[model samples]
Target chain A: MNKIILLNNRPTGKPQASDFKFTDENKPEIAKGEILLKTKFVSVDPYLRGRMSNAESYVEPFKLNKPISSGCIAEVVESKNESFKKGDFVSGSLDWKEYQVSNGKGLLTIDASIAPLSTYLGILGMTGLTAYLGLTEIGVPKKGETIVVSGAAGAVGSVVGQIGKILGCHVVGIAGTDEKVAMLKSKFGFDDAINYNTTKDIKKAIATACPNGIDVYFDNVGGDISDNVHANINRFGRIIVCGAISAYNETSVPTGPRVEHFLIRKSVLMQGFIIGNYVEKFPEGIKQLSKWLQEGKLTYTETIVEGFDTIPQAFMDLFEGKNTGKMIVKI
Target chain B: MNKIILLNNRPTGKPQASDFKFTDENKPEIAKGEILLKTKFVSVDPYLRGRMSNAESYVEPFKLNKPISSGCIAEVVESKNESFKKGDFVSGSLDWKEYQVSNGKGLLTIDASIAPLSTYLGILGMTGLTAYLGLTEIGVPKKGETIVVSGAAGAVGSVVGQIGKILGCHVVGIAGTDEKVAMLKSKFGFDDAINYNTTKDIKKAIATACPNGIDVYFDNVGGDISDNVHANINRFGRIIVCGAISAYNETSVPTGPRVEHFLIRKSVLMQGFIIGNYVEKFPEGIKQLSKWLQEGKLTYTETIVEGFDTIPQAFMDLFEGKNTGKMIVKI
Candidate 1:
């Protein structure tokens, strides 16, 4: 029996598992010029929580009573379209279901031999593309400049810090715990790492670490962390705000240090970016990421859960800062 | 006897007349390569507030017990240097005193034939350069883009709004009073105007006036007005924070909405700029501004106060939102 998880109601805070229900459902039929895909892996991301809420956002909010969907790796079980044949592995955007029918608009064939099929859903997927686009286009790191990244142990932040180091910048990362901070230095080649939980004075700590002051701040955790980062930026500094995970689960508008004045003080440039807007650059970014992976210049690690039923638990772990790198649910 | 106001004390808040005291002192002999300058017109700007504070800034803070000084148009009464002679009009950074000696390094001979010598302090000086550089370099306005300027009646803001209109942007300005707003629309050619004081909801007011959403927000007042302007910005919006007069006097760090997250949502770019950084482009900017003035394509206005003792009062009046356009003290 095929089953799907429906978003029965909108979440107010950290979404409870009860908000989703998995039930038996009919397999979708493939129309002409469409292919039938059996789900192999469905990627769950923190950004999906944003889609659940009804707010002004870059993408449309998810509909109530509809199955949550994202970039899913699937197997083409049957095909009505000449482009896709049976037993081909493909990746595309679709509902959280056991099976799906695709018109091939967003679908792309994947070579499983390159790595694992799941790698496409993480490093070479939307997550990696986001890190690439945000850092390259917005951060614009220069050699010898200091680059600070928040949420440094997470998927995007880890990559951003690593890229900063690769570009010959003095990379400093701020994480929630000692373990994550260690991972930033050991795994990502970050020059300096700050565990915000243990730090006595964030600004002083950053100033001590980066005596020259920060040039680019890749902000993932927006709140007080962003404010402290803003205070340390040098003249003509750039801030690429990718996510505000600290504010995502908030019950109210999160208040921190007012940083509007910092813009004028440092002549700092702060910008936000979404990956969807840079679709044309994705292939080039993926190609570079793939080369780095093959050459051992870039490394990625994921904390995977065995069963699809653990999706909600894995997602909840993300908010609690349990995952070190990309958190993926493997079937 | 020539007397000048000496910088007596660093001001904690709004500087008082007591912070400065007129003292009779010896007219120091002009050394080799130095010239004696009699102040013709002295500039009192909002940025001087920063110089009074001990806070680390782009320029050195003004030292107590010394004559406070800045960019002023002066007449070379006597010259010990070959570069400049007596009776030559020049512009340079010098003491606030009636007569002083300056080395030739920072001095430039002013041409009085083209425009008024005081115009060098407004439309042809640092104020004009600020408006030109901030709009052209950072604001990067495209033709027909809606340019929103805060503190529209001030020295820099007025020039920015007029330049925006010249650059083909639909200019909208925010001012403290209806009169200033009226001036923005009638005198400066702003497409629309918003009196922030009278408006119940700044966001709604900006939204109603700019239906397409603000493409570029040249922020002069960085408080709630900036927050409202930032919230109403469109995708890929650019915000050039030129000054934040509203927050300069605040005793504590002002509390408001977190704007770093908006960078992610709108792909907004917020940058701060000082006009001094673009000195290389100054002559070109002046040439264009002069052409605009000569052709009657642009209109310039100034609120001139006679005498030098009113400098403190002029600086204080800026905080109270008194002056309509470039506030200048004629010596």
Candidate 2:
């Protein structure tokens, strides 16, 4: 029997454990040109919270009673497809199941030789691609300019901060905890870091950290934090809105201080960003990111929990800010 | 004697007559590199309201008890500069006075035979340039896309709608009055017009008017009107934040529905646009606008108030939405 997780209900506010169901099903047979994949590493992300609701988004909403799917690393147990062979590792947006069948359509062959197999789901996966593309294409952080990363300890934010430093920018990170802020400056080489939770005024803290004013804002968090960032934005500032996890689980539409005032004040360019918009340049971005990782210029951290049963709890822990970087489930 | 208006006070809300002081002085002399100018047509714009306050902006705020200045077309009564001669009509940012002297640096000599002298203060001036550069550079309206213009009857919005139509976009205009809405559709060639004042549900009205969804929004009126426009914005939508006339009078920072949620949902690009950022490309834009005017492809409306004393009232009327087009004070 193979275990699978299903979206049991539409989450109202914060997603509850009852909203998901774990069920056992017999592994299905694979026809010709199909490969049997055994789940290895599952990437649980904050964005999954959006998919749990049936709201129209960049990606399709997860249907109720259907098996949940996300970025996953798996081993090919059996393959009738010539493109994929047994014993090979692959990475793709795969279903949350112990065993699954794939035609190798969207799956990419992964090798443990170059990097850790789990990294294919983290630093070398959608997370890395998102950070690279959004900053380079949308934010366009110029050298000598200040780049502030909100949710700076998160998987994507951590990478964005590193890339900002590599681009010869003044990198400032904003995280929830002092521990994460310490990691951002010490481990990630960020010029400065602000623990937003401990700070009396996040806006004033941002101003103190970036004395010259923010030029490039890689915003992974939205709401007042984003508005505060806007208050400190410089003329011709570029804000790459990657995620708004703060308001994702709210039952009703969230409201806050209007943005148009600040936008006009600084003549800023604020754009909402997603990786899919630059899918065509994924190979180019991945190549650059991989090179940086190999050259010791880039580093990543993952909170890996053993067993597929721990997947839901690991996801719930993300909202509580339990994980420092990428949160992955090991099977 | 020369009559001049000065900023008597920084307006707290809607500008009043008490905010301006009229004084008399002897006609000023011009230096060797300067020219004497008799004010013809002075452009009283909504943006001038931003400069009335002592806030950091693209242009310096008006000084208390000092002469107020704006875009003006004046006839050269006496020439001390070789570049300009008597009887030549030149357009420049000039003080609100019946007689003033200029250094001839920022002034552009205009031919009365080519276009009416008053047009230099309206269609062929900053009003035209703002609409052109904002749409072309920031909004980037594509042919066959839907473009919405707020403050549709005002100086910049009226031109933005016409340009959208010229670019083959389905143009929709949002105005406060049914008369302005009618003018937008009939006179400005806008495909559709929404009267936000009478419209019960502005969001629904926008959806009905722009069935294809808004791709490019030239927003001159920001507030609930802009928030409503965001409801119908398509993926990859580009918003040109030209003016926030609605909130300009409010002493406090106006609050409303937050924008980041919709920005993320649609991957929209919202940029605060001013003509100054593209100052280097002014000649190119002006040439294109001039050609359009010459070919009869472009048309403009002006609400010209007579006498120099009307300058303050003309500017104040902008906040009331009294002008159907460019508001100009002729002396």
Against the true structure, whose DockQ is highest?
2
Q: Across all candidates, what is each one's fraction of true contacts kept?
A: 0.78, 0.80
RMSD to the hidden true structure, all candidates: 1.7, 1.1
- The lDDT for every candidate, in the order shown, is 0.84, 0.90
List model 2's recovered fraction of native interface contacts, to 2 decimals: 0.80
lDDT of 2 at A309: 92
TM-score of every model? 0.97, 0.99
Candidate 2 per-residue lDDT, tens place, A1-331, comes to 9999999999889988999999989988899999999999999999899899888889999999999999999999999999999999999999999999999999999888999999888889899999999999988888999999999999999999999999999999989988899999999999999887788898998899899999999999898888888888899999998898888888887888777767887899889887878889989988999999999999998889989999999998898889888999999
State the lDDT of candidate 1 residue by residue for B193-310, as single tens digits.
9999899998999999998898999988888888888878988899888898888876667888787667777778888787767888988998888888888887778888888778
Clashing pairs in 2: none
CAPRI tier of model 2: high
Best by lDDT: 2
Q: Please give the lDDT score at residue B271 for candidate 1.
A: 80
Model 1 pairs whose backbones collide = A272-B263
Instruction: State the displacement of the C-alpha of residue B193, model 2, in Å, after optimal TM-score superposition.
Output: 0.6
